[model samples]
Target: MAERERSVEAMLRQYRELIEAFVQEKISADDFETDYIRTFTNDKCQVPGSEFTVLEKLFFDVDDYVSDPELRDSPEDLSGEQLRERAAATYSKLFGLE
Candidate 1:
């Protein structure tokens, strides 16, 4: 694979791991979103090949999710739960573990 595809693949794995961490409650919502999710600066999260559309879509979704910043006082509220579900869904699709 080319360097770009490899980079995308690496990012896909990283995203799955991070989303899994968020879903498992091993990390806080703020840590997952503000710190990690917000860092997904990929414009076209995929190259010519490699199945990563879900992760790409998740990147766009993260933009909308964190646009207005639903980060509340606590990461266990409805917003946080919603974020968790979203991340979990992405991880599921990325690995076909749904």
Candidate 2:
């Protein structure tokens, strides 16, 4: 149980770093999305020693975050900075980091 918790925490930390880089323009949204999907959704995706069920739930939550309409439709009207801010806020909230 403790090991599973640690794995989840470590995964979330990696995600936070990726998100912060995206917010800072160190990585593009497209690139972030690609990496995020590959990390959590690929067929062979695995977090060693993590409970499969727990990881699955976390991945689903992230998927919902990615598909959020506010973020999805923002490109229609929002400026680059605005989009980044929105993404940062959403990610922080989703990850319980806010």
Candidate 3:
């Protein structure tokens, strides 16, 4: 039980940090998406208070977020800063951060 609690805490911590970094423009959407997958996708634990378990739901959401063509297009056309801003806004909206 204690071990599970710790894991959940760690997961939430990492999620918050990744969100903060993405919002601050410290990490790109792609980076956040990658890190999120690496951190949570393989965790088979069943988290409560959500429909899809944390791993599966977030993995799919971030994958979709980063995979959008408008978001993933060549940097020359959209620019990194613009892409990051758009991604940040999307993340904020999706997660109710704002």
Candidate 4:
């Protein structure tokens, strides 16, 4: 149980770093989305166990954020600014940076 918690915390730290990079414009929205919403989510998104509920939701949000509501019919990606906002928001939520 302790091991699992440590693992989860470690994973969260890695995600925080990635999100910070995106939020800082060190990484492009396209590249960040490719890593975060796609590849990076495959293993962490589900995030079983009730203890990780909020973290799981953040991962899910990132995955689902690929779509823009205004262009629902066409399925457009978010602008760089939008992606940065969300990444910053997610980082705040995940790390209690707010």
Candidate 5:
């Protein structure tokens, strides 16, 4: 379990570095945030919590996805459209929706 925690922490560090580099390279905040959201959502790591908040805070975004009430409460509730809407809203709030 300790190893897993270390691995997750390392990944979060790498993500933060990548975002920092993008910002340094004069990339638009909107583009950076969008890419971050897409990469995070498709990650095989299966982390939990609000991806937007986790990424914004540069924290290891792992949680009990299977056991979390918010996540499992309505497995069939968040449809594709709803997911997209939620993603967009979260992303926007985190990065000021630029």
Candidate 6:
């Protein structure tokens, strides 16, 4: 359990650094945008006909992926409101808004 926690923490840290670097223009937006869009669209989580910009898709992708564990652990643990709250918070962090 401790190892899993540490691994998760490390992954989160790496994700944060990658996002920060991305926001700072250290990486090519084209490459990032392609992968970001692919993840969200291929995941089948987005509503059909939902229009999203590159950044918006990135935010949603991160939030959706990060929240997977919580969702899987206990699907009934989170209400719709709670899930939205979690997604908002996660998106904020990914965007350096919090």
Best by lDDT: 4
TM-score of each: 0.60, 0.46, 0.49, 0.62, 0.38, 0.32
Clash pairs of candidate 4?
none
**How many Å off is the CA of 48 in candidate 2?**
15
lDDT of 2 by residue, 1-98 (tens): 69767666666665667667777789775565566667666535346643445445434434444434456653344444554666576566546454
The candidates, ranked best first by lDDT, are 4, 1, 3, 2, 5, 6
Q: What lDDT does candidate 2 reach at residue 76? A: 45
User: Residue-wise lDDT of candidate 3 within 1-98, one digit each (tens)?
Assistant: 69867666654555666756777878777687678777665645435534235435545556556445566554334443554565555455435565
- Regions of model 6 farther than 4 Å from truth: 34-98
For candidate 6, the per-residue lDDT at 10 reads 44
In Å, residue 38's CA in model 1 sits off its true spot by: 4.6
For model 1, the stretches where C-alpha displacement exceeds 4 angstroms are 1-8, 42-52, 64-78
Candidate 4 TM-score, C-alpha based: 0.62
The runs of at least 3 residues in candidate 5 whose Cα sits more than 4 Å from the true structure, single-residue gaps closed, are 46-53, 56-98
In the range 1-98, model 4's lDDT, one tens digit per residue, is 69778777766665777788888789886677677755455655344564356555545555555444565343434555765787787777777673
As for lDDT, the candidate ahead, 3 or 6, is: 3
lDDT of 5: 0.45
lDDT of 2 at 97: 59
Q: Between candidates 2 and 6, name the one with more favorable lDDT.
A: 2
Estimate every model's Cα lDDT from 0 to 1.
Answer: 0.63, 0.57, 0.58, 0.64, 0.45, 0.45
Stretches of model 4 off by over 4 angstroms after superposition:
42-46, 49-77
Candidate 2's C-alpha runs over 4 A off are 43-83, 94-98
TM-score: which candidate is best?
A: 4
Q: How displaced is residue 87 in candidate 6, in Å?
A: 12
Of 5 and 6, which scores higher on TM-score? 5
